[model samples]
Target: MSYLKFDKDLMINLEYSLYRNILRTNRKGAYQNTSISGCNTSKYQGLLVMPVPFLDDDNHLILSSIDETVIQHGAQFNLGIHKYNDDNYSPKGHKYIREYNIDSVPKTIYRVGGVILSKEIMFSSKENRLMIRYKLMDAHSPTTMRFKPCMAFRNISQLTRQNDQVDRSYREVENGISTSMYYGYPEFFMQFNKRVDFMYQPYWNQGVEYIQDMQNGDTFKEDLYVPGYFEMPIAKGEEVIFSAGDILVNTSALTDEFNAELKKRTPRSSFYNCLKNSAHQFYYIPKTDEMYLLAGYPWFKVRARDQFVSLPGCTLSVGRPDDFTKIMDSAIPHIQDFLNDKPRKNIIKQIDDPDVLLWVTWALQQYWKENKPVFKEKYVDFLFSIIDFILSNKHPNLTVDPENGLVSTYGRDVAVSWMNAVQNGKPVTPRSGYLVEFNALWHNALKFAEEVAAATNKEVLATTYEEKALKAQQSFIETFLNDAGYLYDYVDGTYADRNVRPNMIFAVSMDYSPLDRRQKKLVIDFVTKELLTPVGIRSLSPKGYNYRPRYAGTSEEKEYAYFNGCAFPWLIGAYIEAYLKVFSMSGLSLADRVMIELEDQMQNDCIGTLSEFYDSSPPFYAHGGYSFAMSVSETLRAKRLIRSFG
Candidate 1:
């Protein structure tokens, strides 16, 4: 039985199906994302989006979509759906959908009049290839399935327009055709099993509107170049396969190749196990044996902050400590190189965030604690290197206040935190200075470094770090605690941001917190009353002046609301950590109870995956990127924490 299923009632409901999405990815950094009913609702929605290293590092949508039409008795029934101008969906193929189910993969059943067909989609685990298999479950007679290939050879960040430069011609390959819409782009091939006839009917599909893109203030409408259709005869009980990839392959082996990848995965049972699978999908191995974690799906790149923050949960909690260690080893060199550079004029001046280095320190601490004596001495040396780099204050935005020994970030153009949402190239929430979580992380990372140094008999280095940490802790206590007892969200030399935010929770959640027991309680109480929600923890407390209750509307509006008040499920991980730290078992139980909603949520947006964020108000609509890597990773981490507490 499938773990996640949507019947005709939900599939045919345009509103529901349009909101629901499906994602399939290969570790090679290729992915397929779209609405559950096979409609392209977002610019990121595509059948084939992969990194074209020759052109650029960014993912490009090579094959925007491939629509199917079953020709029976000269009557054409399109099995694809699309949103054109004015929100009009042509062919409205969702109406024919009988059921949509997801177990190990996505399977959709379509019933058109007297004919019954089922489609299954999967990706190659070792290659950037996607395969779709269709079986004629029950048919009255012989029918022909025509697949209309839509090509939009453009970066996923941009939209395509009707232009004269499009290479409309396609070269015939084995059982398919290879085509490139423009020069300097990878040639995408669409192949099918059995004999097929390709009709060169090249034209422009204009006015294709993506509602999500429109809302995000991006180009909503685009024109795709259709290279024509491949018509293949089908018989009852026959299975037809289609493959989309960089190069054409033997069509006969696609099914076997796909099945082999499927069986290679460890079997999953519960929702958390399903999430582990989703976490695994975020791993990108660009080279022979070097793997890194992609931040999120559809748009995010491999970021150091995301890779570290999500590593413990994505790997360690899933009983793959070796993977976690390898990822850490891979990321250390990058961090070291960034820190070796001279100071930046501002935090925003450096694209590789300083917070990423802090998170790396924290991630190493966690992994080391769990698997003591398992890591090599070189890993410990790497930790010391990070410490020396931090102490040097080589990052322009980061400097230690000698009087207090506390780290401060001076920047105007960036928030310097995860709440980074820029609209007009400026932070929505300009968080400069000594952010509460920043200091908390700083203290924790230093404490960790001191321990590693001391344990390795480097007393001088250890003593230096511990003394600095002590002064920072005292300064944090004296400077951050407001009259309300909650830690100040951000404190500059002149001003302190009194906004009650989830950032303060990190202070208590960290392995070492400067806050006393009473202070920790106060911060937790304020957040629980104002920021905690069933969906996730709110970025800003509702009582705050900057609060945005819901995240929706135009691109500007969404950007403004990005951190002001959107609820981020990923934060629940830290909140749960703080809860356990302050309240012990009761805190963990409360977190487990709150997380109950996530099980049902998995059936929504991205099946078997968690969304990046949600609206802060009622209904709490899931927003931002779907199948976000950190969200899935952190959710799995929280689950493991809860289990351990029990």
Candidate 2:
């Protein structure tokens, strides 16, 4: 009865099947991703991609993939596919695939000769462990299953080459073998529930080309070090569970542990539940004592803006106050960095984004609205500190314009807000001064902070923030509105970006909307006429001069097209909020249609989860990161909003 399944017709069609992928996460920052047919089509695709604590705290593909073959009556059927150099797919294991289903776990059934085998893949919730259960449903005779374990032991973002430094030797444990290619890498342990004999033959799987990487202008071909195969006798009705982890484990208890972890999962009956379940995949508790979110699967790390933007939907909407509190508490320090504009390393330096602070305040406001706290002294002080930082305008790159009370990027070369798509060290969309969404969130933050301050009995702070918010509102309404009925996307000196974009939707979507009912209707109508798409709202309306309909080609080309016209599924949530705000419950029909459109996308790139973006043109092909946290979380939020209206 599961709707998420692919039959042999589609499974055997590489043109269609190769584009479709599957992802499994451990909720602790580790994940497994590959093509639906178990082919490694992308460098980010792997059987075991986990964060290695000892090796600089980045996700590494310790195990690239494992291929399974069935030996019955001396005939072998390889149920594994790999793309070699020059775009050659060896063994062509997908040809034997009968069915593939992604319900709870990714299950693939293969029919070879008279033997039918089913493989189910699952990951442990709290640990870096992956379990693959193989069941022989129907077979004419006993079958010998051989598994070849391919180990990369390199960063997921990088590729590996065949080298003599790789250690071929492996230590045999109680019911498994532990292997590591080099020093500083976590030793990977592969074990099985049933007794099996491991062959000592080791070889290099060279020229394994990740097609998607080549298309992205990255190192596509990699050399995988695969130690010998494990041969086990499996009869009809017999099941075998294969487990892999960073540390040694008791093989016998893996099944029971996996089952117990399964018991902890919420039931996924609807598309909303599916998205809600995937939202948990992004939740990570690293060395930081508080919970954080990884932006996306198989690649991205924790980002300040992404975490804050996704927090309310991923946690608060699910009625998880404890998770919300942990996430907010952990994120406060990062938001402070944005306010302070303190220098940091690579990605953290991006905290200077004016929108990060806005998102943080908005998240806190949403949290406070849901559960009115009795003024926790520490949290209240934190709120006051944020207000002080924003009003002081001490940051080097960001400043609050005293005249307008609007926040803007101080430097000329800086891309402060989320429309940040940089190429060759220059912003694709140079939205430097007073971005539409930034000022909208800015107004909302100040208003929310004023309320917070008043609730905490700090009357002076409340009055100051109230005055500042009103000033910003006055300037925003006077300066940003255009004759076209939509607010300008950004205003930097005399150059005002008068593009139709989803950024203006936040003006009316937030709780303390700065726009009046009439203006809200104008903005909503403008967006609906131009920016709205089936998947989400486009970054720039096609009617604009700068709109890019497609997101494709080289890294530089894609980066240029990133925010220029790419459609973000997360923005759909704001569009829904704006629709409901402008038309009240009467807008439920349109909002429901938007939500349903996004729901259909759960079956696309990453099954049961939404992608980060899509093309702005017809069909709106999903692109960017697969299993994006914001996409999943915001979809859940939009669904909740529509249901509430109903």
Candidate 3:
């Protein structure tokens, strides 16, 4: 039996299948994303999407979608669905879907008149390629499969229209044709494993709309270029593979290559396996084989803070320490460039986020705990340099307080920390000056650096970090602890914003904290009552200011509500850590209860992955990135922690 499958009753219902989408990544920044019923519902949906680094850092949708038609007795049935204006779907091909399953990769079975067809989708891990294998399961007569590809050679974040700039020509490749709609992009190829016929009919299919983007007040209509169709015959029980990618392929090897890549996939049989599969998708290497972890799917790029925060769980917790070394091997240099005031490098644009260096410190701490030999060999000196740079007040945005030893940043003008949602050129939640998590991370980094230095026999450095850590501990208690028992979210001069945000939970969750055991317990209790939800940790409590619980409104309104009330699944790991630290064996029941509730979310919104943010109130509608890197990473880490308790 499959772990996640929707039957014909569910698949034929457009209401059910349209809201749920599936994403498949090539592990190299390219992806194939669309709804489960083979309909493109968002601007980000595509079959062959790749990053053209020469043009920009964003991904371009080379192939928006492929429309397949099953033909028998010269009668054609289009097994494809596309949304247009006024909630109308042309051809309404979803009615033919028999079942949809992702037990391995995505396999959708469609039944036409007397014809049962199955299509399996897979991605090439090392290359920018997507493959779809179609098998005529049970056919009453000779069947011909027709493929009509919709091309959108534009950035996935933007919409394309009927324009004259498109190159409306094609050249024959191995068993298919190669064409590019725009200049400065690679020639996208469509090939088949067997002999096929290509018909040349170029036209723009306009007014194709995306429902999600439309509701979000974004430009949802696009015109896709259709370069004719392909015709191929198949016998009953015969399988053929269709390959699409930026790179040209040998047509004869399509079937074998698809099977070979399919063998590399880790089956989504269990919760851990599904998360493990999702974790592998965030590894994006766009240029020069330089590895980086993309923050999330469809939209987010490689970010310094997210790279570090998500690296340990996505790679280390999933037991891929070598990938951890590989990605950090490329990232450490870029991070150093930012710290040294050098020009920006190729990827990882957000190195200047206020807490990026602090996150790197924590990430290395995780590495050291996992594998000391590699950590020392690759990152020990680098760690020492990062701590030394921060201690010396060299970072552009961060400075260490000489009196208190806590880290501080100026964020009244521009938001500097991870709560970086902005509206109208101003920060929605400008958490500046002695941020709670920033200081928590500072204290933890000092303690961790002291341990590393002392173990490495650096007595002077160890003593320096230890003394500063002590000063920071005392000042943290005096400055952030409020009359309500929980720590203030941030403090600026005489102003202390005691918003019951999740930032305070990190102080209790970290390995080294200034708060004593009693204070930590108090924090956990307060947070559990005020902020904790089944989905994850609420960014701010309902009793706090700007308390908008629903993640609905105009685009700007949504941005304003962001970081004010949206509950983030990425906080599950830290929340669990704080809970387990305070309650230990006794906390397992409630802790596991929260986690199990989140586990069911794997089947919601997106299959095998968690969304970026969920509504804080009941029904917890997922609202942000469909497949968030931190969400999968932290969930994997929490699951591993749960096993350790047993």
Q: Tell me each candidate's TM-score.
A: 0.95, 0.96, 0.98
Local distance difference test scores for all models: 0.83, 0.82, 0.88
lDDT of 3 by residue, 1-646 (tens): 8888889998888877888889899767888888898888789888888889778878899998899998888898998888887888987788988889998799999889889999999888878888899999999888888999999889888889998888998999888999988889888889999889999999999899998888778888989999899998899999999988888998888888888888888998888899999999998776565778999988888878888889988998899998888898888888888778899775787788879999999988988998887777778899989998998899888999998899999998898887889888889998789999999999999999999988888999999999999999999999999888999999998899978899998899899989999999989988899888888889999998698888887877789888988899889889888888888889889878987899888777888899999999988989878999999999888877777888
Of the two candidates 1 and 3, the one with more favorable TM-score, higher being better, is 3
Predicted candidate 1 versus true structure: per-residue lDDT over 1-646, tens digit per residue: 6678899999998888888888889888899988898888888889888888888878999888889999998999998888887778997999999999887778899999889999988877777778898999998977989999887988988988999998887799988989888898877788887778999988998888887677666778999999888998899998998988987798878767767867876444568768888999888787766778888888877876777888898898888888987777666556665766644322112336757778888888888888768644558877877777778877667777889878888656875788888868888788888888889999998888888888778899999999999999999998899888888888887799988889999899888888888998998898889998878889888888878978777768888888988888888888888888889887866887878977778888877788889988888888877888788887888888888888
Model 1, residue 533: what's the lDDT?
85
State how far residue 310 of model 1 sits from its true place (Å): 1.7
Whose TM-score is greatest here?
Answer: 3
The regions of model 2 sitting more than 4 angstroms off are 334-349, 374-378
For residues 379-454, could you state the per-residue lDDT of candidate 2 as single tens digits? Answer: 7777767767777876655579888888887435656666767777877778777778888988988898889888
Error of 1 at 170 (Å): 2.3
Clashes of each: 1, 0, 0
Q: In candidate 1, which residue pairs get closer than 3 Å at backbone N, Cα or C atoms, i.e. clash? A: 344-396
